[model samples]
Target: MKIRDKILSGILLVLIGVLLGMILMFFRQGTFSFDLAEVKVTEVNRSESPIWTDDELEKIDDRFVFKTIAKTVTPSVVYIETLINARDRREMSPGEEEDGGNFWDRYLPRTRTVGSGVIITADGYILTNNHVIESAVRDGINVTLDDKRTFDARVVGRDPSTDLAVLKIDAENLQNAVIGNSDRLEVGEWVLAIGNPFRLRSTVTAGIVSALSREVQIIDDLRRIESFIQTDAAINRGNSGGALVNTSGELIGINTAIATQTGSYQGYGFAVPSNLALKIARDIIEFGEVKRGLLGVTIESVTASTARRAGLNEISGVLIIDTVEDGAAAKAGVQSSDIILKVNGVAVSESNQLQEKVAMFRPDDQVTLTIWRDREELETDVVLEEMQPIVQETQTIPENNFDEEQLGPEPEMWEEIPGDENSGIEQQSFRELGFSIRALATPEDPDRFNLYLHRVQRGSEAWNRGLREGGEITEINGNRVHTLDEVEKEITDSLKNHRSLTFKIRTGQGTDGYYQLF
Candidate 1:
């Protein structure tokens, strides 16, 4: 009986312990339920419409025109992204040189620039600005279409003179823009600017043609041809190489630049005419280079003063300042101080107009120039010559080569000459001209001193007039300057006489550019 009671008590203790553990676990976990929740969903009404209104289908309004242009032209525009290596990196503005920066910044590994391009061929021939992809690395250009497809692009050719370049891709059946004649485009006509501005893809803006044949002096190349179509369209940095089309969705120009002080759109925009762009594109694709015809004459605008001085009946031509020796113009009996009244029967009042007209032809092509000489108009046939490339050797001037004491005229020679305030003549100083010269010594003839520009202050009058550092000054005021003294003397005499000073300069790039200072 006693053994049976002990076994029963141990069994009871084990059962109680197990029950206590279960209770503790239930208390820690709080509560539990066995429930299955059900979901209930209801359907909404949906339908399709096939009805159309005659007003919506036939009535064409300004909004309809813009919508049609956007739908037709947006697909033709593309986004271009380029990877430029450090060695080939250049400033965004060609006319502006990179002057100040940390040494390490110059050696950055890589940089990227974004712009836009227009498809010009069904097989993926794209037209863009030279500055857009000029120095990109090999296999670094990526073009994105409106459909979000991206492809690698290859450069077909580039023309720095016109700031135009052609690109090729592997894609086919691309949407291409229909090019229209820019010559027929007139001021006050409605136009559209299409581009990927500020990374906003396929942006379209509307404006009117503000002006024509404008020379803004933005191109840095001495042979640069800048006869841009000016407009009030809003264009930003990334809009370079984009398409400027008419209301009919015809491509009429290539958006190139903007006149902005804050680096954003402020009303003014410029474009390369489609006529010139198409010509350059065709040449680049056919010959791998722009076969530009050279007229062999340096010309300027015939202003009222110039017309009065030359005894012209009207101010309606370009003044021929000089002619290339043995060139086509010289061979055709063209002389300095003559006025070019018309080119091939087209009246040209500005130098840019003449340049644009002549740039349309090829080498060996003949052009008739209506020239005014000795108060009479005479027609002369000038066969355009093949343009010869200007080869320039990068010249490095030795530090401290200029001796301030030995070069330039005495300070007393440039005394401030007071001008009559009543006559509206303002006193001008030679020192404020923004440039200085020094005598360069050559190994061939150490005794023969050659005048070279020492420094040209940026944003100064001289710089804006296309004077740059390291340029060789061959002549000043039509007089050959072998020494800095001659340059100083010529400049002093001109400043004192209140006359314009003409400088014949061989630029650092070894191209000849005539600069005039008032």
Candidate 2:
């Protein structure tokens, strides 16, 4: 009995020890759970900390940048509407009722065109493309501003060579765009195109400057001047005359055209550089016309063949094909085969670049030209001249002292001959030249006889060459012809020889000019 009691006491002690250990473990586990909760709270606080400072945040906000530019520049962009009168349809002749009975539809139709423009002055001077307002009716032009204010705009002036026009609106306190230096613009710099594209007002598109000094023959003028800035901006039909601004909301260019196969934007857009646009605008505002300087030298871009012939290491500079007589270049001793390397210290690689550079000057501006001739670099100072329209001298022939009755029968008899007659052969041959003439004698000056063109056949070479009714033929093949017989004989002989005939003619306004018929 004494041994069993000793074993039972030992078992009771072991149970007390086991219960105490369990209580200690439970308390320790509770403390560990409290510590873990504190660690999680600290981690959450760190993660919630601001990733960017206030200044940094503002700097990185591209939306804010674009929005600020749009807001500042959009007000300067205006929408333009132009109305053009359509030509009258020809009256149908008798038995020509085959034109669906719409003959003699004397109703004139007016065509409406939409475009964009940029305000350049506080007194409401706007700049746009000349093509946007070409042939626009005087009272049919209107401008709509951002504030929904509409005003009738008058054309200040237009320069077809540069495809630019200036307009004046009768308003005050207009929002004007700040002109920026396009020469300072770098490729890949961000830009914004603001305009009314497809008549959608206040449209803004973002892009980058893709190129500079791009030459695209978008203008059809004979003396076209193009030095365009190329971009990837979205430009459409109505975007012409819009503003192309930089990130600072300064106008760098005037959106002019887009290179696209479709009528809409296809990733390539063009603009007139701000410098050139501003120059043209200022000139028109001050002078009512663009006074373009002329170099009087026909130039071509340097090609591989030309470079090789000139012994050039690389195809660069402009090759002078010919120098006009008594022109600025001729006076400056510039000759054909001379390679123009630079104008006024600016390197020129193409003919258009040189032309544009020269055009920026005034008529009397003295420009220094660096030329490469005979493996030597030579510099010449050329004083620019005003570009004049090609004018020919009217060759006046002395009145015939012979009597009219001895020359031929009555003039009306020539018009009444049958198709099989000899006179008909002469008439048919004359008609093949695509014009008819009549001799006009002035009652006040009876001895003065003039041959005036009364008709020009449609689609004829004479008509295509800009000959019109009322033009007086002054000379043919360098010979003064006073009678219709002499004129017809010269034309027939030239036709038989298959040679081009040159006619010196005088316009109704007394402007003398020459035309070629082949």
Which runs of model 1 end up more than 4 angstroms from their true locations?
Answer: 1-64, 86-109, 311-313, 392-433, 437-501, 504-518
Could you tell me the TM-score of candidate 2? 0.63
Weakest lDDT window of 10 consecutive positions for candidate 2: 392-401
Per-residue lDDT of candidate 1, residues 354-470 (tens digit): 989999999999999999999888999999999877532112222234453444443433444453434322232446797666665555765456666656655566765667656
| Residue-level lDDT tens digits of model 2 in 229-264 | 899979998999999998788999999999988889
Candidate number of the best lDDT: 1
Segments of candidate 2 deviating more than 4 angstroms: 1-64, 88-109, 390-518
RMSD (Å) of each candidate, 1 decimal: 12.8, 15.1
lDDT of 1 at 515: 76
Give the range of the ten consecutive residues with the poorest summed lDDT in model 1: 391-400
- Superposition-based RMSD of candidate 2 using all C-alpha atoms, in angstroms: 15.1
